[model samples]
Target: MSDEVIPETTGLRYFDEWLIKKFLFSHIEKRIAEQSIKKYGASPIYLSERSQSISSLSEICKRRGILTGLGDLDFLQNCSLTQQHGARSGFVVLGQTFDKNLGEALQHHAQLIESGSIQFGSPDTEQQIAKFVEGIISPFKDESSRLKVCEDQALDFLSTAWDLCRSLIRQAPGYEPKN
Candidate 1:
């Protein structure tokens, strides 16, 4: 698919710095440390200590006005997420944009869920998916069911993207993309 055809919302700009950070913390950093140790016989302790020292220095530079910490943090965090997604630097830009779009989409979906238009779960299900969706869209109305539609749509989009990536990787050799 052409780059433009991949909805800007589906790429990576939809994610914010904080969400990217959470993604990295949840998925990437530890894997990178593990890989480094396995490939180079590097000591995790030394690697972690150096990483911490570099991070501290970066913070100091940021505080001293030598660098914009926000940009650095965003770059580092996004880099990690992109790496985890097996996306290249160009794709990282796309992924960051997609992440931003995803955040906006989620916010919009949440609004719908809170409105009560999207109910799917029930007290018996114990899943609370319906209730969670309702809570997200509730601000629009004290009682509504329209939000469920939007939530389902968002979930579908995420599912499709996951499937597409899996298919693409399976079709290509040496498919891993570097950050």
Candidate 2:
């Protein structure tokens, strides 16, 4: 008899197990790479260009009598930025933009929480994380506090994921963290 291992479930793909294991093993590395790029500055030129293009589009839209809301303007600007600089540059620019947005959102949520405008635990996990950072940063009453809180959160998230992966690799057979 052949010694080949076959999946017990018929509907699953042939390599589903390998794929799942691979994803779990590499997820931490992916997070680290993302955090590192954000922290160490991967491509500032791309971001600068993206921001400039967005501003230009907003100006053009304004001059053309287009009644674009801020969200629409922002979306169009991002599209233009991405188109001009290619997908990779666009990805980095958008990633940083998202990070900034999260920080702002957190601050806003924190304000709502402080003012009793919103109930605690009502919002999703992302909203909660943002609110938490906002609260921690609020006490300092300076721009640096917000920056510090964001940086701390980013690092903490990355480190925690990495440590978890290490633990999993130690406990599971055929599981290895990617370099």
Candidate 3:
């Protein structure tokens, strides 16, 4: 289902922009690293086999499950993982190209992502994000309570980040935007 195409809407358009920005940042980072190595005659950095295997470019995301499904397991003599465990066993990798506050919030949820406890569009995910915003906005407030984040403020934050990232990418030395 990852290959399935979803039509663009207001929400999806934003999603697409976010994804493209992530890919662009990674591409530019790699290019810059390569240039630095060439200019300084420094040794190239090598990635581990596992890290190299997980290429973001290879993962085509669609409107599908946040976790990957386990393939046929009838061949196993004794399977220890139950259906529930199998359902949430997959991991979704996220790239960091935004503010530290966002990165810290994501870091807090990294465990949940790895554990398959949080799904896309889940209330838990929203709650986490809200909590993160609350922490930044109202550090003195009680952590036990949930703070309602203004929708407009959230959207504005994202828009500003998107604009800033685009501006920085354009200013990147020798960076050329594709036609």
Candidate 2 lDDT, 9-92, residue by residue in tens: 335443234322322233333344457688995632232322333232222243665533345333433433323233323132
Minimal lDDT window, size 10, model 1: 105-114
**Positional deviation of residue 152's Cα in model 2 after best superposition, in angstroms:** 2.4
Q: Model 1, range 73-141, lDDT digits (tens) per residue?
A: 444444444333333222322223334433332222221111233334644454466565656655434
- As for TM-score, the candidate ahead, 2 or 3, is 2
lDDT of 2 at 30: 39
On the 0 to 100 scale, the lDDT of residue 36 in model 3 is 69
Off by over 4 Å in 2: 1-52, 55-72, 75-141, 168-179
Off by over 4 Å in 3: 1-16, 42-144, 147-179
| Alpha-carbon shift of residue 151 in model 3 (angstroms) | 24
Question: What's every prediction's RMSD, in angstroms?
Answer: 18.3, 24.2, 23.6
Question: What order do candidates take by lDDT, descending?
Answer: 1, 2, 3
The number of residue pairs in model 2 that clash at the backbone is 0
How does model 1 fare in lDDT? 0.43
Q: Report the CA-based lDDT of candidate 3 relative to the real structure.
A: 0.40
The residue pairs that clash in candidate 2, if any, are none
- TM-scores of all models? 0.21, 0.24, 0.23
